[model samples]
Target: MKKEQKESLVFGSNLNFLRTRKKLSQTQLAVDLEIKRTSLIGYEKGVQPPFKVLLQLADYFGISIDALMRYNLSKLGEFELSRIDQGFDVDITGSKLRLLVTTTDKKGKENIELVKQKAQAGYAAGYNDPGFIESLPKFQLPFLSRNKTYRCFQIDGDSMPPVANGSWVTASFVEDWTKLKSGTPYVVVTKDDGVVFKLVYNKIEEEQSLLLVSTNRLYEPYLVSVNSIAEVWKFETFNGFEV
Candidate 1:
């Protein structure tokens, strides 16, 4: 989609969801807004409404323009898990949602989820699925940061050396992709590449893609679009000992 076209896509779904919630038909809403019925329909289809008209709609709906900007229609109760704006759901933090299972320890701290080496494939396929995440084994790691969510990944190949094969990596869930530093390592979950541990660079400004580089220079870096991304975890700490 053109740069202008991308931002408008979320508008249609949000408008449709909120309108249905209020039990207002398009024609009735149009009458309320004092606009032509077709004009309202165009807005629902993601056509950019006039600036003044857009503000009027926001005021009429009791929402802010910023709220409308991030409004994903995925909150419309559970049907079947599809995708979230071609990504994952943005949760209460105004950041991407992570499937975290928690239990209080003696110190009342929550345990982090661990994805073992053998279970890597399952994590790749089921990372987005609530049921799948619920079934994974979780344990408490004392050294982790208290307020953040994290996961343990079991690596397979030598693609990322100095970190070797059959070792577990502890990565914190990254909610905001924009804050990611260049040359940082991430365990990025994607639809195309399953689960990968790669060095990532931000290229989201130039193109809607991220540059994934391998630690081992033998492997070539490639571009993966933001749409194909499901989840991104920033490397925090790792245990090189094979368990």
Candidate 2:
């Protein structure tokens, strides 16, 4: 057999196995690919189609051509799978921590692979170290626990200027409310406004409301109901501050 024919036969067997595992019939696979049933039968029978058709089949099956040919089913579990705009999820369960670097784009317009690559590079460069991560404390709230290695976000707004406008701020999950003191800086997530890193204060005469203060003079402190706040991070340190 020719090289192309041999490669196609290998892919065809793997494709047939995957289809069978998925419990899809040849006719069903043809419908999903928007191809005639006879074409899928020909592919399964070791017949190669044009490059364009092969590419379409690969895309529909969500597998690379090499994977289809080599047929290593074990690697399927390690596949970097994600839905568009859903972001990537890393499970570091046994390690007691997980690093999740979500895209900075709120509109979810960034490419997922590019975002993952950037995040991975940042982590590889020791972005979590004290100097690089501690400088963020002045502008936003830091986490309560100093022991945990937290992931910092690169802030984009001038509203929290001078300290965190263009800096990376580390955030940790807050576990104890009693550890929080009045006038402490924290990253607060509310039910309505999403996340805000600001200093929190207990307002007198209003047990249900607390003060949210911004270090930037242009922004004034505001009151938010305690019930509205979902999460809080007591400020930590950071080193890299461009603004």
Name the candidate that leads on lDDT.
1
Q: What lDDT score is found at residue 86 in candidate 1?
A: 31
**lDDT per residue (tens digit) for residues 1-243 in model 1:** 874565566776667776776789999899998999998888878888787877877777666565454445444323211332333332323154544434454777666777877777777778767676767777877777787878888887998988888788898888777667889999988767778899999865444457999989999999876656778889988777655
lDDT of 2 by residue, 33-94 (tens): 88899988888888886678778766766665554554333223222222201333211111
Cα lDDT computed for each candidate against the true fold: 0.72, 0.53
Error of 1 at 55 (Å): 6.8
TM-scores of the models, in the given order?
0.60, 0.36
